[model samples]
Target: MKKTDVDVVVLGTGNAALCAAIAAKEQGASVCMLERAPKSKRGGNSYFTDGAIRCAYGRFQDLRAVLPDLDEEQIQQISMPDYGEEAFMADLLRLTDGQTDQKLANQLVSRSFDTIQWMMKQGVQFTVNENQYYEKDGKRQFWGGLPLKTKNKGVGLVQALFQRAEALGIDIKYDAKTTALKQEDQLKKLIVEIAGEPVEITANAVIFACGGFEANANMRKTHLGNEWEKAVVRGTAFNTGEGLTLALKAGAVRYGQWDGCHAHTTDYHAPKTGDFNKPGDIYKKSSYPLGLIVNVKGERFVDEGADFRNYTYAKYGKETLKQPEQKAFQLFDAQVSPNLRKEYHLPEATCYKADSVEELAEKMDVCPESLANTIRAYNQAVQPGPYNPAIKDGKCTKGVCPPKSNWALTFEKAPFYAFPVTCGITFTFGGIHVSPESEILGDDKRPIAGLFAAGEMVGGLFYHNYPGGSGLMAGAVFGRLAGEQAATFCNRTKPLSSKS
Candidate 1:
């Protein structure tokens, strides 16, 4: 490959990268996207996800859909901003231990929605109302709606962004991976090693969209700690956090490390060898309070469905160690599989099943007698106001969430099932420090000239807890900011103050 130049050189080709490239091009700045992976493999694991972002506007809408009974108090419980920027800043403080620059977080949060509308104009789709308005809190609200309307929502939206990015004449290169960020005279450049040669491109702005390091297990063990490595399999190999590495090498500020985690899940469908996840892998469905989680000892442990967060393994303040198997079988009934709850995206696909408790135990690899007693005892909770202390005291109690129907499953019928499952991490919370203007920052909170950040790559800008579809919302948000801001910067370039 030959050398090239553009106003912005974007690494990675996922939602954030595509969003940034589109943003820069729309703002009239030349932008080029380089993907180390081939086009067919180019659909990074992000495509498999439902890009949840927690923008103030989006949360209000999603809450209407998922939690119809929600109110101000519930909103306070779920959103990051409830307590103040201090609570919202908690993750950043823990990640950098109060060493972070707050200016960047301020910038990303402020510009989020403007970013969303910009993408909407670019033809990226989203969900909309059935008629003229959506029902919310017993009232009607009307927003333009998401560009994509399928049940598989964000997937289509991302596809639309990809299409628009190509249509806009943005340059996208496959198999052009950047190895590092090289700085000269205090300026940043991408170092690409292609076909046994090093190609350097100095740019007005370098946007780090390369994803989190979930796939890179060794690296995960190093920075994120060994517990993460043992907890979940990587969802996207493309998201190796290479951009994060480059940003770190170039002295970019880091924030929200503690905020990021291997999104704890009932399954990422790791294969038997523990090698990279294969394409055919399917997620086993697990429902809250409906199933009892058992450890190897045939004893119930932590909550299987709650936000296990890393706290599940605090070891009373010691370094959190990996839990064995990281596997917990979800025991749901004939009804759970047929109609999984409303909030989940995919259909409920389950694992082993049997008519009798003895047979179900055989499939789950637990003692049939003990397993039978566990289910029988749990079923007894249905008749009363409170659950049996023994059953509630089990590790399974940890994962329980309200609206969770533990009593709904009586384990009473024939053909019960056990879905052997593992963990799935969606995104890491830590990312390049950026401003509300989407400007990438240096070690000291100053803008690194000619560089910007956006999407998941920019951290600590979020409100406290995740809002549904907020990740996608934020990606659109920051991508627009980066593009618009970089355009303004590029536009401001003037004829050298001619000192003739």
Candidate 2:
């Protein structure tokens, strides 16, 4: 019903979209952002995350540049290892099993720390992650790779970006869903739904950063195979693939793994869609690395300790989906019970406790006989070694199928706990193909003029899995690039003003 024009229009309001808008505005382009969610739930997948962004750092000083609040005591308390761009690249390629695009991976790693510093200039604040690391014998140690996160978690991350964008005069429209896109020569048009009514927006250039199609059950069942509809959506319900779909309709090339996604071990009782009230990844159950996980048949399906939790957690949910009835349970003994993440303690969490393995299985409705045999075999196979949670201790099972390759310990301690778990789809890896400059390419493998993409919507950076904390990093890196490029494109081609 209403028509408006801007120099640049950014789709979505998460980290990627916000970064794109900020960069475009800095380039002297009048920017407007379109968000599908309501004002109260504006942030997309970025709001549901822990706000961890993997960055390449050469020393403590490099970290201090972004996290200025690191006191001498806090610095002395932790072991800060130098994580270079080479290490970051290796991690990306290794986690994705060499399926990540080399160019995209290079850009993500090289720009990671610098992007965080740039975000700091834009009022985004970060701190060393306490959740991913631990303190032992007065020496704090980092685990699951290099770590940095927003000071107030996901909420703070988005709020900081929002503050910067607002300060820069970016117009953001919430409850505006982009339904269709049309090209009128040099100008790009977007038809959006606002309060159940259609409104047309025209822009010189567009940056698509809305995210993937993880929330669409139909898309999931189609691309991700059968029973994927049962996977719990771990982020915004609004990211149902319109961005990727409309872009493809307008000649964007589809790339990356059509069946691949990033998932997490979420509580089995989590809602079908992400709970807006529980905004900060509270539904995730990350304690499986310190324990054993089994299906309803009481059998370990995958190696729980194949790698650090950061690398393995993203793919474990898929293995969970393949289990019987798409359900599994994590069992932890009293010795390692206190080491679980903060989410396990939430009042809404579904957990059962018992003094024995059979009792625990009974409470969780698992086969008691099979669970007892599995536990007995696991305990018998655990070879003794120095148990270090900060690194791969190689305390492993000697003769078990799908052995616990690290942090292996007997489950003989009393007061055992079991938590039911299911797959929580974070974001799909199938997305639009883009050039090194973040320009979305068409099926002919050429960049489409006046169009760019960032975040999860621009795939080829991941495949079957991804390393934890890297999602936000990739989002920031490509978001900045796409924004800068879109701004340049818009300036090169002047479109008619809406006021005309």
In terms of lDDT, which candidate is strongest? 2
For each candidate, give its TM-score against the true structure: 0.72, 0.98
Candidate 1: segments with Cα more than 4 A from true spot: 51-55, 58-116, 128-154, 183-188, 195-197, 230-234, 258-260, 266-286, 304-322, 341-350, 382-410, 461-468, 494-500
TM-score for candidate 2, please give it: 0.98
lDDT of 1 by residue, 1-500 (tens): 45555667777777777877887787778777888776766645556554433333344443244333456664443321121234334543443445444665444344444555555576654443222223344444332222122223446556777889889888887877798777665335677875457787666667777776666677667766666565554345667777787887777877766435535344425432122223322342324344555543454454433321221212211111233556556566664444343323334344576888788888777888887766666565433344321123222321223222323345576667665555665566677777777777787889876677766677774322342244555666666667767666666652111112
What C-alpha lDDT, on a 0 to 100 scale, does residue 119 get in candidate 1?
56
Instruction: Give the candidate number with the greatest TM-score.
Output: 2
User: What's the alpha carbon RMSD for model 1?
Assistant: 8.0
lDDT scores in order: 0.55, 0.89
What clash count goes with each model? 32, 0
- Total clashes in model 2, counting residue pairs 3 or more apart in sequence or in different chains: 0
lDDT of 2 by residue, 1-500 (tens): 88888989999999999999999999888899999899899889999888888888767667887878888888888886778888888898898889899998888988888899999999999987878787778888887665789988888889999999999989999888888999888789999998788999989899999999999999999999987987899999998998999999999978999899999889998988877788888889987989999999999998888888888888999999999889999989998998898889999799999988888989988889999999999999999889988888898999999899999999999999999999999999999999978999988888888999999998799998888889998898999999999988876786443335
